[model samples]
Target: MRHGWEGAVLKLFRGKDFTFTVTGAEQVTERYRRVHFTDGGLLQTLGVHPTMWVRLWFDNAGKPHQRAYTLVDPDVEAGTFSLEFALHDGCASDWSRKAEPGDTIEATVQGTGFDVPDPLPPRMLVVGDPASLPAINSLLAVAPKLPATIWFETTHDSDDELPFRIEDHHDLRTVPRPKMVEQVKADLQELVTADTFVWIACDTTTTRELTSYVLKDLAVPKDRVKSLGYWKAA
Candidate 1:
C-alpha cells in the first residue's frame, strides 16, 4: 500500500520503516485491546526508550492513514512488543480490532525519544486519558520509586478496566473529560513544585490548556514539564 505524502515527508526526515507481523492479541476490556507483534528488527535497529512510539500505517478505504502507538512490554532480545488500543471509531482502531496472527502492518519511526531528568524530581504530576495510557504506563515504569499523582480522564464506564501500571507510590484520580482540566488546575499549585516533573498526554485542547497554565500561570520551567497531545477531540 502507498503511504501517501506523509510517508514521503517522513522519509525525507530519515524515518526508518519496518513491517511488523502480528503474533497474537488480547482483549483487555470491552473498550480496549492489546496486539502483540514481532518487532521486524525494529528493536535491534533503533534500540528502546521509555514512551517509545511508532507511526503505524493503515488502509483507510484505499487511502493511507497512520496513527502513533506506544510500545508496550518491549523485549529487546525477543524482538517483540505489544501495542494497546483504546478502541474507538476510526481506521486505526478498526485495524487493531481485526488484527490476527501473521497480519503485517507498515510502521515508521521518527521524532520519538525521551531523556530522563538528570536529577530525579521529588514528585510527578501526570495527566492523560485512555489514548495515552500506554505511554503513561511507560513513564511510570521508568520511575517506579518516584511518587506520582496521575489524573486519568474517563469517557466510558469500561475505561475503569483499562490497564494502568500504577504502583503503591502513585496516586490515581479518575475524572470525567469535562472536569479533568479544572481538577488539575485546582490542585496544581499544591502538587507542582519548582522541581516537580509534569507530564501530560491528552486530547489536543486539554494538553494545550494545561501546558499553558503550567508554563505561564504557574511559571514552571519548560524543561521540567513534558506535554504531548495524543489525539484530537472530535
Candidate 2:
C-alpha cells in the first residue's frame, strides 16, 4: 500500500550551528515578520514535503527559544520555503530580526496528522491568534465551497495580515489582542449552530477555555470541535 500524506518525512538538514542568515524579511505587521531562507542544500537534505510542519531551534544571545512554524509556501522545485514569525522582544524574535543571508540556523523536520474535514459543513468556525494563522490559512486553502466564519484575535491591527484566498461564503472577524478568548466566545455564542464544525488554535490558556466552551457551554459534540495549544505564555 502507498504511504499516505501523513507519514511522509521531509529532509532534516543540519546547519553549521544554531544561527540563520536573513536572506529576506518582510514586515507583515509591527509584531510579525515573513522570513525567507536560501540554503537550498539544507532544505533538499531535509526532503521537505508539502504540508509538513517545520520546527526551528535557535538561541537568542544566551537564551534558548524553540518555535514551531509551518512552511508557508514550500517550493520543492526551487528549494525555498517561507516561515512566518510572530515577533516578540523575546530571544527568537530578536535573532530573526538580525539574521541575514549566509547565516546558519538549526532546524528540525516534522509531519502533521491533523485531518481536514470532508464534505464541509454548511458553515464552519476557524478561531485562533497570530501564531495559529499559518495552519488556519492552510486549512482554509483546501476547504470546500461552504460558508466559513473566521475569528482572529491579534495583538495589533498590523498583525492581521492574512494572505489566503477568501471565498464568497467566508467571513473574517478581527478582535484586538489580550481578548482572544472573550471575543471568540462571543463569536461562537452568536454564530455557532448545531451543525457547525469549529477549529481553534491559540495559547494554552485560550485553548483550554475555548475547548471547554465548545464542549460544555455550547454542548457541541466532541468530534465537531478541534482545539490545539500552539504555545504557552512565558
Provide TM-scores for the models.
0.99, 0.77
Model 1 over residues 116-194: C-alpha lDDT tens digits?
9757888778899999999999999887999889999998999998898988999999999879999989989887776
Q: lDDT of each prediction vs. the true structure?
A: 0.93, 0.69
Model 2 regions more than 4 Å off = 1-22, 38-51, 60-64, 160-165
Clash count list over all predictions: 0, 12
Give the distance in Å from residue 84's predicted Cα in candidate 1 to where it truly belongs: 0.5
Q: What does candidate 2's lDDT look like per residue over 4-60, in tens digits?
A: 222133333222222234577787777777888754454566654323566576664
Backbone-clash count (model 1): 0
TM-score of 2: 0.77
User: Which predicted model would earn the best TM-score?
Assistant: 1
Query: Which runs of model 1 end up more than 4 angstroms from their true locations?
Result: none
Q: For model 1, where is the 10-residue window of minimal lDDT?
A: 189-198
